[model samples]
Target: MSCEECCQRRGLGGRMIPVPGEVAAGCGLAWKTAPEAREELVAALEADGVPVEAMTVIELLEFR
Candidate 1:
């Protein structure tokens, strides 16, 4: 997330759930979401002109 204020600006509030492993890895913060939602998320970001190349999609090994 950009900042605590970012969520409020985007009206995302509680929707921006935190990812577990990211904080442990010192990655600051990440969005918690299901693997199946990847495509829709990517499409939404792209549609909003958010450059998504820097977005990393990590699939849990067990899910694979």
Candidate 2:
């Protein structure tokens, strides 16, 4: 999605960032944010009538 669309839909202090090649092989963007904020973020998007049919939920493993 475009930055404008993401900015208008996202609730938290999130921004569209370049997708990692390991995540996907294309010139695409994804929203970067803290995992704890998922609920509020989703709620806000729904409240704003943003269609989230294409949204994917992925758990990233933290390397210590």
Candidate 3:
């Protein structure tokens, strides 16, 4: 169960993304998700006892 896998399973507009240059949390990957789902996502991750560096709301332009 990789980080990417967990996010994918949520099906809440989550995707694997590179960690922004300004932040470092041992891993080079970050989870990108919709702002609306942030609270739910945070609760889930925390409940699972996942090691998270930080939760940030990054404004990204979704390209369809």
Top TM-score model: 3
lDDT of 3 by residue, 1-64 (tens): 3556666666556778778755665558778777788788877777667777777876777788
lDDT of 2 by residue, 1-64 (tens): 5433654655367667677556677867777666677777677766666655344556655576
Backbone clash numbers for all candidates listed: 0, 0, 0
Quickly count the clashes in candidate 3. 0
Candidate closest to the true structure, highest lDDT? 3
Which residue pairs clash within candidate 3? none
**Residue pairs with backbone atoms closer than 3 Å in model 2 (clashes):** none
Off by over 4 Å in 2: 1-11, 53-64
Candidate 3, residue 54: the lDDT equals: 76
Point out the higher-scoring one by lDDT: 1 or 3: 3
Question: Candidate 3, which ten residues in sequence have the lowest lDDT sum?
Answer: 1-10
Clashes of 2: 0
What TM-score does prediction 1 earn? 0.43
Q: Model 1 over residues 1-64: C-alpha lDDT tens digits?
A: 4432443455443344344463454444555455666666655555556543244556533352
